[model samples]
Target chain A: MARVLIVEDEMLVAMLIEDVIVDLGHEVVGPAMRLETALEVVEAENVDFAILDINLAGKQSFPVADRLADLGVPFIFASGYGAAGLNERHRQAQVVQKPFAPDQIASLLERL
Target chain B: MILQNDTPNIDPFRFLGKDGEAAEIIRTYDWSSTPLGRVEEWPPCLRTSTALLLQSPVPIVMLWGEEGVMIYNDAYSVFAGSRHPALFGSNVREGWAEIVDFNDNVMKVGLAGGTLAYRDQELTLHRKGFPEQVWMDLDYSPVLDEEGKPAGVIAIVVETTERVLAERRNREEYERLQNLFSQAPTFMAMTSGPEHTFEMVNPEYQTLVGDRQVVGKTLVDAMPEIAKQGYLDLMDDVFKTGKTVRRAAERVMFARTKDAPLVERYVDFVYQPIRDERGAVVSIFTQGSDVTERVRAENHQKLLINELNHRVKNTLTSIQSIVTQTLRGVQTREEASKAITNRILALSRAHNVLTAENWDGAELRAMVVSSLEAFQVESREAIRINGPDLRVGPHAAMSIALALHELATNAAKYGALSFSDGSVDVSWQLLGDKFELDWIERDGPTVVPGDRKGFGSRLLLQVLPLELQGTATIDYRPDGVAFNFATSLEAVNDRPALEGV
Candidate 1:
């Protein structure tokens, strides 16, 4: 079982992603709802994998993703927006589209 | 008997006795003492009237006794003044020598015994009382003798300078209006009455309506569609309110010809109420300009912006694939970093081509050459590029560049270019709006990178579908790496590179 961090601003989408992760035999860490909070969680906790939304309420989760990368934690991005919304370096990360099926989320997590 | 200032009547002269009053007066007149000279007899009634005419207010003159000259009344003496004082009973030629020719012409008609009536015959006379020449319209009539011989001439005159000047000004005003109507560039038409029935249309108006038979027709009759679009209603409003209606950017579509496409136009127009002397609306004047091109340009710009958004998203996905695959194959950190940086540089070079072309599209040959330049340490013989000139869009160009770079790098490290006797062949062709290119490596080391699940493998298989809306296949043969891909030329050529799929 993997300990996964969820970083998303929208409460509804965050909850949906969290439900999918928990169903996938993964334990959910603090579903950090903001970029600052997500960054702090990444520094403080042990995360096996992270599922990030590119945009928080009004902030980018790029900083958290960068921190995860430094910590050697694998992550996938779930976004409604296209790849252009991400920074150049992070474009290679696995992306699961929004309103995605639970199985698609599991497969993306499996790939990571 | 006669009163001095009242009215007078008298038979004063009895030259031929009462039995022959006309003959007696003609024989007794002293013709030599006036402007007419050496006259023997006058016409019978003129002879008697000549003595009485000297007492009248209007100018009167008599030529008596065949002298063919003039006589004067009391008012005429004052008008004639000191000049030609022998005006009465004087010879026309000898007494008034300077004016004899004019007198002769008048007398000649009388001598033929014809009554000559000349009305408003302009004459300029410089008389004693008038220092400057005065204009006059003289009417001369001749009185004949019983024997049909010339006796005298009568003159009446009037002047006409002011009337002539007024007519000239009226003509000038009409010409000015005609000049304005013909030269105006805007569609202009004059309509009569509140119904705004077209009375006349300028050339521009005729061109706008695309019909020659617009005149004498109401707006509804000529172009019912215009009425349906509320143009006629607007005219009615202008007439009712006595106010002008000015509309800008008014959208309309006009049919130029029966078979032609409807031309969409935006227009600015004015409907001005023309009022009569009673301050009632008599007509409406309409003037308008077509502005279709400007509106179309604005719509095109908006479409371009939306397209750019999609292109940027697709571009990011491509970079992501490159990164993920490159990192996947690397066994060492340094090697992974180097591969990623090189791939990034390849992507950057494609972007530069897009930027230089303002994202419209990049040339296929140019993109190929740019990608191969990094790997090409030698001349053209080392790398054979064979293809017709073509262009590729940002998405396709970037993908193709990275793929080429991967192939070239592999060639340099282990295949053809790894030794001094190796070479590469690249060729492309256009199939409709899609471009197909092949990168074939030859004369290389034995082609032995056998089934290694590397970054290059994943890139060729996965990235093309997500980024280019195309397909890429890499054939691992015993001879060399043969790579092929196909994508839409339109996808690569559309402007602002962000626009296409």
Candidate 2:
């Protein structure tokens, strides 16, 4: 089972995604709710993979994505605006729009 | 008087050239009936001049002495239109009857040993059996007799009608283009050469640059800031490549006057290159419209749409969380369904409160009243809610609304509302930077504390304080359940949702 990290700001969304990740037979890392916290988790943990929300409160999570890329950890972005919201650097990365089904997350985890 | 028959043996008309129609016309004409009499009596100057003009290709006509009699060659016949053979020996005044006075001036000037010339002279003539307007370049010089005295006027006529009319049409077309350039709604400018000198600037273009006198000045000279913004480079690229450059909704900074502050504006523009006949770039034509207001409105709309999408997605996830946890806690499908509807309704009611405030912030009193609206109305009067006028940010307001719903739900089920005489007191205040709120139940059934770690208790004890970045507690008192919450005022009145994103 892969150790997946969740970086989402919405409290229930984070919890719901955490539940989904655990149900997919994977160990869960931080469901970091802020950019700084996500970056800290990426630096401190032996993360195998990550699911990043594009927005954190009023801030963007691109810096977290950058840190994850630097650590050679693969990740996908989850956002309400979908892939259109990603900047130039991360535009080609995988994206899963919010209000996602558990099965969508499960299939993505299997691919990871 | 000289006689033509006496000179017939000498062949007096021998000087007339053997080629052209004018030579035959002169030979067969009855010149003896005119004042100059016959060809044998003609002066040597007239004979020599007529012969010389007849062989020449230019249109030439000579008027002999006294009555100014007309003599011309083949070329002049075409210039005469249809008034040819009938005009051979006719007097100059009656030959071109429409311009009799104009020819009269020419006759008097030439016979007096003076010369006259007119370029593109406009005149009316009936050469075609009808009056027609024409233009000609006419030159008149006196032809002297053998005695070196003024004798007759020799004239050369060149019709300039076609050229004059073409020039007039060209001028009219140029004026029409000038009018369009001046009145166009879009700004337009022409800059020439590598210096990008502004050669032409219409009124709309003038207004775009705050009516600056930009004509004849290089773009860098008139607006150095624009050059710094890299528009000068763009123009140079277009000039060198002879290609067109288009930009849309691009930001530019401008100041109305030298002392004024720079204001940001957006524009949609094109730079088109003008080429010479050799296909070399010579000038850049710039045309565009100031689109600051349109761009700003579009940006605001995009922000609103994104904000709306984010909120909707988050609210759906909140409902998802409610449904999943509710189903896990309930004993039956009926109980789960009722609890899911109630939770979603609570969330929807909170959204209404936030929407009323445009999602900026909500009044604490409004949140309190709306959250308790679903409870038993007979018990609403018993629920005392007292708080100073306070505004909480959208996230804080939504969390507090849900937390209050949970507490009231518990009160209606087993606390204050379950007993008719029971009542609840809810109050909040701000002291310095810290905020404090209290919900105390009195005169209710004795509360039985249970280790119920359900969705409602989790929201009250965990999510509310975590979201608000503060502390919250619920005490199962023997009389009722009491809940107290405290956080910083800044956390309660946080920045509006969707700001800076």
Candidate 3:
């Protein structure tokens, strides 16, 4: 089982993500919702993969994404606005539209 | 004096008596008797009745008693044809049956002892041997006898077909030019001589002048200032050189009426010399149009686009701040979930501000008032706001709104708004294109930002710059937390306040 990190502002979404990861036979790490807290988690914990929300509350999670990249951790993005909303430089990163099925999430994680 | 042979032939020479008698009669007779002699000398065959016609270019016919419309010596006998033998003794009517009515009219007028003159008359006559349609201006005068009674009629006729046709063609061309001038859309005028005196003006030209008399007057006499400004000089140059001078897209300002606003116009004109037959320049023609409204509209549209760009940039910055601050507030799993929802709702509210102005910009005080409404309802006395009427762009509004939310959340949880004794003061001042806003807390529960970094601190320090392109400072005073923000005025005014939200 892989250790996965959930960086999302919404408690329900984070929980749903946690459930999806657990169902996938993966261990869940801290679901750091804010940028500062998420960065802290990335630095302290050994995260195998991460699921990041483009916007956490009012703040973007780009800093967390940047830190994850530096740590050589693979991650995917989940946004209500879809892939077009992401900047061009980060567009290559995998993204899942919101209101996604569990299997879709599982499939994306498997690819990653 | 009948020098003819002693034969039975009736000698016409008896009518003249003898050579000396005929010579004496001719000498005493008035050579200047006919009115035609005033403009033209009589031809040598004027007194003949046999068939005398003068026809160098213009055919002239003179008929005397018993000559049957005798033509001058130069007149062709073909005009008489088969009737030539009988024409010597016959009257004009019997000799030329086709011209009987015309002959009768002239004969009647001559018989009444009056001169008959027809300026232009069309006549088809079988003269000599050929039939031809001839236009003639004829004058018939009677020669009186000794008792002052009519005896014989003398005809003076000039063919005028060529002159009449030429005059008709000239009139038609002049009418066509007038029609074109009247229908022209641009203002057109003609000025005479180097003095540039207005000679003629079209309807559009009259309308453009608007209450100014522009005919038969020099430009200086009509508008002294316009003449002084080298307008006359241009006309003078065209006249002197006999060359056309064209002025294209020249800007000019004029008042429509005495009390009307000055209107700007663009004029395109040509001053060409109107030369006489001698090829000397005499006048100049000018034409032009007015284009003020179109030019003004183009400039106004450009300004509106620039204003739109400024507002959009500010809005993006505000959204950035809201997202950053909301995420900072999320602590536990439950709070993190709630914070995201609240932040999105706040962002939607800001979007409403954008929509109100159709995304142009927003009001300053309104943005602050709306953002604090949620926090204000829970605690009335805890908040105090002070600022004059102001406007902010969308970016500034969003940043300020998110920043205020953070302060209020913290105050409600552990700072000033947490207790009845605590209070918060929000005040702002304008400084050029930027506004300085201060949020100070007083009489609150023992003040401290928890040692661990919180969402409020991160928003006040780091997120403001990333989002608003602005700066925010927070002072951890023992009394409370004091926060100051400096941002662009465009950001504050670009996002108008949301209504009914």
Candidate 4:
């Protein structure tokens, strides 16, 4: 089982994702809420894979994504604004929209 | 025919009496101090010419003898400004000290048998309290003595000050109006003739037209971009019929920016006909303003508002998903109602946490506490939670809230919370590249695994792991129930996009 990290800001949405992670039988790392917090977690924690919210408290999480990329950790972006809202550097990364099925996240995690 | 001054037949008042006003002034003037000392001693030629000057309606002054002593008529007095009655017998030099040089020139020329004339000779004279400007057309003719020698000069003066000043003021006013037109904040242009040739365009209009040469060129030749745009036609229509045409706003492309691709601008304008005497339309007047920025800002706001509506609709759909999932595979109506209501409340509670943070995220500790608080499991230390300060995203927060509510309800009914002394310990730790959370129950009834999969079991075994991109397990130990959940940090922390409405 792979360890997964969740970085989103909405509590309800994060919880739904957690329920799915648990069922997938993989170890869970963190659901970082702020970009700075996510960056710190990526630095201090042994995170094998990560899920980044394109926005963290209205701030872009690209820096955290960059740190995760440097360490060879796998990750995907999820945002309400979609791929068009992502920075040019990450426009091609995996993305899932809101109100998504748990299976969508599961399938992506399996690929990672 | 020459008459001597002493001739009995000659009349002393003969030459002076012909002009009533001049005759009165010269008869009364005191001339005892100088050459041609008195009126009776004046030379015969001087007297005759002075009489002729008096009768003439034009302003004239007759200066006789070496001193050029002045003798003038009523018209001459008015042209002399304020130096009138006092100057009747005074020398020309004394009366016209301000323009003595000019008068000196005239005297020298006239006495040498040369005629002198000047048109619009300008001078500044302190005639009143302040200096007054004056212009005149002057003519000086020499009058000979009885011996035919040059003796005196007759000056004909016509003041043109009022006319010159009026003309000057008219030119100044025209220039002032031109200044206002160029400096005005709006675009202005004047087109004449049927072809709508540009007669005039102010600086504001020039800037709006960019690098194009507008003035002296027809509308199409100057701003060809607007030829088919109907602006030239509008000017033509207004010019041909003396009618006014006004447009509130029109999008026109003037290629205002110096680039290959042109930019369109919205302008509010009016074209009016200028009519001369007899009401014939002479020219077309156009005025306009650029409204591009204001219109674009308004359109951008509308776009943002539409996006906001779509986002709100997506959030509502998320609520629908929670409600739909909770009602699945329920036994009784009462059971179903309880389950659905409790799940919705769980979702709402998570929503509340996210709302407090502007839907950014929530604290994991806070999410756990608030989610289980609905069941009163934490009262009297019945439940314990252990973890560092970890933040949870909105998506995870909502799912976990419902999952936690389901877990607590199961514990209350069949596990640790079913008995008074029973307790539940919820703790989490970060493993290498993985996050682990455990829910262990203790001191309750003997635990047995459920043979059939219920909604809660399906969520724990299937839905939860799928949503988190991780794994979870339930152990039906004889003492109590224990559930351990783990997932990758990346999966849980990832952002989600908003689905379209």
Candidate 5:
């Protein structure tokens, strides 16, 4: 099992997502609730892949997504808007529609 | 051959109906220079034809004998264009030298026992002082003597210059309108009949549909894809009812390349019926514009709202998960469930305030009332809310709401709200960029400071500071419990405070 970074703003949502990650036998890194913290964790933590909430609080998680892409880290976008909400640069990136179950995260991680 | 003295006494002059100015001119004309001798000397066929020509209501002329001299009616004087009285007995070549070549054809045909007629013939005639253009309908027929031989050419002329020019102008105007119709910027098409055949389409439509063979083809025949998307039905409905149809934005999948995926597009369009003079629908004018970009931007905004809604739903799910997970790790289920339900209810109250303002934020006064409103005493005097209105973002509002709910719950159970003499004053102040809220309880049961790490203690003393990105402290005195919290105003919603009393 690999360590995964969880970037979600809603505290309970972030916790539940961490629970799902732990349930899948993976060590979770910073479940950052904001874009700045997510970027800092992505830079500081030794993580294999990232689970990015497209909207981190009021700001977009695009900088974190872009930073992860620059570092050649595989990541999946978790958004309620599905793939259409993504920009042209991340159009082909893996997407997990929001309010996802633990197995969907596991499967996405497996694919990554 | 001059007929000055024998003008009114001659057989043809006196024998025929010598009415009108043309007859007077002819009876007195000097014909010595022309081939015709005189009115009295003209052959019987010529004399009889001259009388008919003079009495004609329409313009008429006679070019008689081998020399082809002119003799015309008064009506013909107008067609002669100022070549009137002098032209009555002048040679046709000498009088109308400008169009003599045309007259030569007429004379050659008429005198050779062939009739020649021209309708609305355009010719320039030398008349008055200038060579003028004129259109005329002319008929030339040969007249025969008693021996049945072709004697002279009789011409029936009617100038139609005004009518011809008017018709030309009308045709030119029609052509100009046609030019505009073909090149208009907006997509335009005219479809006729139940089949909605494309009667005409402009260049915009041609390019829009990828230059498909649309004109002279039915709508379904031209583009079969629209039939599946209810477009065919809509068009049929509009045509049958003659009612206009306008779609603000419709998504269409256009297949631009073979074997490739359908390209999605958005368009705003209208179908307007064109009626005939009888008020019957003859065709439909289809006009529209591509609105894909605007529609996409609108959908993006909708997605953002939907994401917010999803977050709300997910928060509810998370609360459920918390309650269920806490049940597995708790000492008393009833107390834990009660506390969880109460906290969740407070969060919902905060959400209600935020929802009312389109999720932008919630006011602190409203948030306070919503959090403690459920634990209300019989009299409103038990609780005093005094604060300048503060709007805080959803995260901070939720934290503040839960903190107040916990404090109020503790007061109701053990501090102030449990007794009739109890009262709680909730107040807040904004100093520079710092926002601070205070809760003071009085005239209640004696406070017993506990060292236990209960859910209420952890929630009130720790969660408020952590959640709102602020700080909080609680003090227990002999009379009641008091709490004070401070946070950055910027972290809360940034709206002007309502004037407070």
Candidate 6:
């Protein structure tokens, strides 16, 4: 089973993503809800992949993405802004738009 | 003796050639009564110069010898105004006595074989009966005798009052226009030639462009950034076509201070080509206003709409989770429908409190009251709520509201509020920097810890603690149920950033 780190701000959304990750036979690392916590989790956790929300409360989650990139860990952004919100540096990274189906995450996890 | 006198009164002033009024007056004058004796006794050089002066169309007058006697032409009589006829043979100093000192200087220079000239010289003269301010151009040269010695002074007087006054009026009008240009409220600039060289910039234009020394510099050299942004091309088009170009709420990046970071701004502007008299494009006049505030306000409104859309979509996802989790816990469709309705209603009530506060935060007491209102205890005293007026952030408020709903629902079904005499006391307080709250039930049916894996139990035991960044516990006491939650005040009151994400 792959260990997937979930970084989302909204409680229900995080819980929903947590349930989806668990159903895919993956071990959960943390659903870090704040940018600072996500950054810490990226540095501390040894995970196969990560799912990131573009916004944490009112802060952005790009710092966590940067940390994860430095560690060579794969990740996907889950945001209302979708791919449009990313800076040029991370434009090529994976993205899932908000209100995504469980099968979307399932298919992406299967590829990883 | 009669034959000697019959020389036919030989015209002594025959050298005065023209038949003008001034010439006639000189011819009939009693020259024998003046310092120059008679016209026949006059020196040959004075007679010759008078002939030359009278024939010319220009206003010319000859002042003779030391007495400086006047001899003039038709043009000079017109310039003399009411001082003519009698002034024909008068002394230069006595005839223009109001300006005797000025004439004295001219006579001194001219009779000494020197020349004098004045251009638009200001003077006061009694030309038409009253002293009048006038301007004139004057030239004086000495007349020589047969021996090449100075005998008289020849003077040319040209009145220039009209020209001088017109020039003064033009100067005043120019000064007024300059004042208006400097004090104008909008940004304005004038650029000349094909190169678009900056000729003038007003205060507002200077402020708009970071107060740089832009005058005398080409538009490209003064603002390289603007040139790179393709605005110079637009100006070039204006200069070439002699047309006006206008733009509204266009984005421009500029550093308002020297060497400062580039800041984006919006502007409404026009470039109008100024033409020469021959209809050739000579320059461009630029006028504009900085509309950054208005543009930013419009952009902020769009962002808020998008954020609201995102929030609504996420809330729908949350409701989906509620439905999916609720179905997994119930046996019958009726039970599942009631559970989903109550859960969604609980979330909606929390939203009502938050929406009233514009979602910035909510009062803890308001959250508690709203959450318990769904259970309908019938009497206010059955559920006692005590807390300081503490405001929690929107996220914490939502979690606590839902959690309270679950706990109260459980109490009404089996624990405290199941019987009419049962009571529940909910109280909270701050301990140092920590936040603490309790929900204690009493005087109801015996409490039983049922399944450990229901939606309500999982949310209370797991989601509430995670959302609050705190801890929560429920003790299934035989008398009733007691629930307590604790966290740092900072965690519960995490206000969103004031600026939009």
Best by DockQ: 2
Ranking by lDDT: 6, 2, 5, 4, 1, 3
lDDT (Cα, 0-100) at B52 in candidate 6: 92
Q: Rate the local accuracy (lDDT) of all candidates.
A: 0.67, 0.85, 0.65, 0.76, 0.77, 0.86
Worst 10 residues of 1 chain B by lDDT: B16-25
Off by over 4 Å in 4: A1-112, B1-6, B12-18, B27-34, B37-52, B62-66, B97-122, B126-131, B137-154, B305-325, B328-501
- lDDT-wise, the better of 2 and 3 is 2
Question: Per-residue lDDT of A16-49 in model 5, one digit per residue for the tens?
Answer: 6766788888998867766777888888898898
| lDDT string, candidate 3, B325-386, tens digits | 44544567677667666666766676677578664456767777777777774636568889
- Lowest summed lDDT window (length 10), candidate 5 chain B: B492-501
Q: What TM-score, computed on C-alpha atoms, does each candidate reach?
A: 0.57, 0.73, 0.49, 0.57, 0.55, 0.76
Pairs in clash, predicted candidate 5:
B392-B493, B393-B493
Q: What is the per-residue lDDT of model 5 for residues B195-224, given as tens digits with 9 covering 90 to 100?
A: 899988888777666745889989888778
Model 6 interface CAPRI class: acceptable
* lDDT score for residue A91 of model 4: 73
Could you give the DockQ of candidate 3?
0.02
> DockQ: which is higher, 1 or 5?
5
**Model 5: lDDT of residue B31:** 66
Highest lDDT among the candidates is held by which one?
6
Model 6 C-alpha lDDT per residue in residues B1-501, reported as the tens digit of each score: 354357767666667766867777877789888998877677788788888988889999999888799988899889998998778789989999999999898888887999998999999999899999999999999999999988889989999999999999999998998888899888899999998999999998988888688999998889988888988999999998988999999999876676888878799999999999999999999999999888888888877777787778778878977887788789999989988999899989998999999888889999999998756566557899999999988888988898888898889888889988888999999988999989999888888886667777877887777767789999988778999999999888877533453
Better of 1 and 2 by TM-score: 2
Per-residue lDDT of candidate 6, residues A1-112 (tens digit): 8999998877778777888898889998878887877888887878899999887777778888888898999999988777877877789999998888899999999997
Residue pairs whose backbone atoms clash in candidate 6 = none
DockQ for every prediction shown: 0.03, 0.36, 0.02, 0.06, 0.09, 0.35
Quote the positional error of residue A98 for candidate 6 in Å: 2.3
Q: Candidate 1: where is the Cα deviation over 4 Å? A: A1-112, B1-33, B36-158, B292-345, B351-363, B379-381, B389-399, B409-422, B429-436, B443-459, B465-471, B478-480, B486-501
